[model samples]
Target chain A: MTVAIDRATGKRRGDRTPRPGLGRRLKNGYQRHWYAYAMIAPVVIVLGVLVLYPLAYGFYLTLTDADSLNSARTIGVNEIEATYKFVGLDNYADILWGETAYDRFWSHFLWTVVWTAACVTLHYCIGLGLALLLNQKLRGRTFYRLILVLPWAVPTFVTVFGWRFMLADSGIINSALEALHLPAPQWLEDTFWQRFAAIMVNTWCGVPFMMVSLLGGLQSIDSSLYEAAEMDGASAWQRFRHVTLPGLRAVSSTVVLLGVIWTFNQFAIIFLLFGNTAPDAQILVTWAYQLGFGQQPREFAQSAAYGILLLAVLIVFTSFYRRWLNRDEQQLAI
Target chain B: MTTTTVTPAAGPAAPDAAPTATGPRRRRGRGAALASHGVLTVASLIALFPIAWLVFLSLGPDKDDYLHPGRIWSKMTFENYSFVLSETNFWHWLQSSLVVSLGTTVIGVMVAATTGYAVSRMRFPGYRKLMWVLLLTQMFPIAVLIVPMYQILSELRLIDSYLGLVLVYCSTAVPYCAWLLKGYFDTIPFEIDEAGRVDGLSPFGTFFRLILPLARPGLAVAAFYSFITAFGEVAFASTFLLSDTKYTFAVGLQSFVSEHDAQRNLMAATAVLIAIPVSAFFYLVQRNLVTGLTAGGTKG
Candidate 1:
């Protein structure tokens, strides 16, 4: 088959003559690969318009003093008009240093980190624990797995809203607390409790993904490794530490990384829980959206700056993560 | 593929170890297994309790009954459901959600299928780079894009329109779906393409006739994912659509919650109604979903 294709290509080359025009060569190349280009054109066009353009425009917006009300206003120069002024790092400066009404950037930034770390750590521990339990030879494991994974399958908005109601002052949780003769703290009123509740809600929403993914990872481990370790008289804890942890390392890292990004950018649950009112519980994402659209003045540029900072943080984190993963992959290969 | 690495070792060791392993470990294993089961049962209940609570609240008599907590299950009623369905624009929201979600799914699946095929099968310049670009897009926070997207849509006069929302959803859905479909495509043997070529089919013809038929599972997985993403999306939908009648379920549900914060029964009823279709769809395609998602993660 290779020889036949080579011979056909050779004949086509011979038929094209010693020096084909550049246009002819271009046309031939197009003819050869037009179908491939055609297949990919819609995806490229749509993504370019909706994703790439917006991304570039967002960066541009970060450098200007655009707002919701005056977003359409422009200063006329000669024949052209510009809706926004070139503020040149003013938004970033205002958020990072200058005193403004939206000066909660630092606090929100810190909380975003704390929120992500707590959620990811709890999610990993709970998920891995559940997955390991499920991995054991138990009857009706499928039913248990399905029930555990139900949190993931349900729409997140529904679950988050349900949780809000459940944690309400007059709701089931406080009622249960009363039944137990225990005090139920305000879940969403106090700042500390609100942050704690947000983490809990996020953990509840995230654990299923981690559980399912880690379960897959656990299933893929060689049971013979366990037997080998057993033969060596290794304790169960030691075997799990040495064998199971290493086996799950790759999957755990991926799950944690993805979880970090998702939790950091989580908007709906927090938004629904606090509405447009909770300043104490706001993360960078909600803060950015509130700045851009939720508020009266609607500081578009400042919001874009917040977004740019988030993007930078994610990029830095991802690069470091990829480096660590690559090192692990190399070690595994050896 | 990694599963193959385990089988060879496990096959010989299992039978050899079974008899010897059972005697000593059985006693200890029983106790540990019981403990594990107990913990798992509690965990599962904790995981499911909120959803179960929602179901009860939705069924309970009225908002006051829900606030009373202990009075739940005292009397069952369907008045909340009837009220949500009849009194408000719940049906209108449902219809809007269906149209937007279906539109996103159809367009997303079509784009993913073709792009997946091209990237997997064709020898194109920068194809590898393109794949990485798609992956990177998944890491982007949607908040970053919302400002520019709002501006772009407003300029095009697509704000408050289904087409604009669908387009944004398609863009968001495309990157992951394309990568997933591409992973699926990679699993299919190239011999199928060779066979199609020998049978005198063009590249497009082979893709549409042979490759696509074999890749139906991939398409189904992508379609279902796209549908769910669009269906549950709140951020963009809330930002883009202004009118109550044009609101998707997620946005509409939020409005309902804000307007009736004290009315837990009605809120729960609406949440249950909104969740039923997605849960049903998820249950139907769960097997494919797990495999597809894991494959995309591990392989892509």
Candidate 2:
């Protein structure tokens, strides 16, 4: 540490003044920022121990061929050291392109994309619609909002179970369908139904938040803009497109980013609703989870690789999205 | 200036209406109001159906009565609720869940406030980097962290323990809370901090005695968020809490579903029991939640 500090000291800029002593410089920085450092110490420590360290450890685990069976264990001090061998890049390779595993990986990735896209789009549209409706001088607006936001207020696992109940083969939804003389398909059994059920429940669970968020966005828009648009003889659609959309730009971007990330990694709905069901219905996050913990002979290395890949995909997507948002700056030579 | 800077976008959030509560908005035709109401009512029905169905199912006498809806209508009873209360480990799960959730909320909020205030008020050498890290951490989610989390938890002999779960929940909640509270703290005036310093108060005194009390709304939002997040978490709870005795509601509820038998009635009862308190808790804090959320969200 002292050597590193000494190295830092060797570089002097063109300010032809006497440089402070190394100890004084060190003391200065500490005196200047100690409060800030002290304040953040708990956060830094907690995040380090729980997240960063594990992330580093998870990367290392991915380099080895570890599984529940072969990995180290301690049964009351009868310590069994890990027998798993270092097989660098093998787990990643197997997960990405090994024939049987590749099929699973690619299919799950595709579904995850579809699921995330479908759910976020639906949530945003429906939420925006609901927000727009409630933003008016309509009767019982509060009443309607309170009821609509119920799903979000309830715990996710509970609501997932609620959907599971209603979507079951002989559950009320099917029973209602049959009574109305509509054909009742096997919701719990069929692959299409499984995927549909997952998306439907997630959308139902998600839309309330989007609605509330967008509603907040709607409220925040200056009413004077609407009046100005009206004075200019802009139609409702025209006013919405020009005024409302721009006004909502900030809230919309953040929520959409959040929505994408949340929907992409949605686990409890998939896991609790369909416990180790059809592989075709599984998304990548849940698939990785099932690999690591849900199934017997838990594939720790493979699962960690899947997780790293998922993180990589999200980072790539976010960076691209950021670039797209900043494209106007480039175009205008800002 | 801070208020306008936030554009602090929270009001009685409209479901599908404008906040143009005066002037020409009230002059909309009766037909338009009816149409808006019609759409909202239908949407509300769709939103409420599954939950309402769960509550109804919970009252049925037999577990299989859901499959035969006609039987449930004929003989509705609270037997399932009784069974879930008396015959199972429901109380234990509920207690453990509350312990972990409360612990996470207390620790997460306390830890985050300092970080939040630091980032909001200070420009230390690594401040920008810390903010960036907090932002990036959201994308590196539960899936990526689960395996290593398991390994670390076990090493500390923390698996199946409430403290273990609380610590794990903190990793997910604290960073986000820090990010959020920074936005909130930004809304508070710098004059107050200066005033605090004038009174010969240390930075900590100024923060805890002055800024914190004033930042109640933000702290409430942060606390509520932390509580809900830790309460509803499943992947970690199911994996780390190895024994049934340590199971949270999430872990315990799943056992009923995967049992290869009909326990939907009891599951429904438990679901209803859990949802009431949580939903009520949500109701208490939702206004602040929305306000704090949009304050940060609008800045994005």
Q: Local distance difference test, per candidate? A: 0.79, 0.81
Candidate 1 stretches with Cα past 4 Å from truth are A1-36, A73-83, A100-103, A332-334, B1-21
DockQ of each: 0.40, 0.40
- Candidate 2 per-residue lDDT, tens place, A1-334, comes to 0000111112221121123324334665566388889998988998888788999999999999999988877988698888999999998888888878657798899889999999999999999888888888767989999999999999999999888778888788888899899999888789998999889899999998999998888898888887776567555655677788877776787789889999998888988888887677889998999899979899998899999999999988887776665564357455
lDDT of 1: 0.79
DockQ of 1: 0.40
Candidate number of the best lDDT: 2
Candidate 1 per-residue C-alpha lDDT over A1-334 given as tens digits, one digit per residue, 9 for 90 to 100 = 0000112223443554324424434656565367778888878888898789998999999999988766763245332234678989888877888885344788888889999888989999889888888887787889998889888889988988889888888678888898899988898787898888888888888899898888888888888898787667655555677888888775676677778888888988898888876787999999899988898888888888888889888878877877767666568669
lDDT of 2 at A267: 87
Q: Write the per-residue lDDT of candidate 2 for residues B1-71, one digit (tens) a residue.
A: 12211111222222222334444444443546777788999999998888888898888877787777677
lDDT of 1 by residue, B237-274 (tens): 99999999999988887886567666777878999988
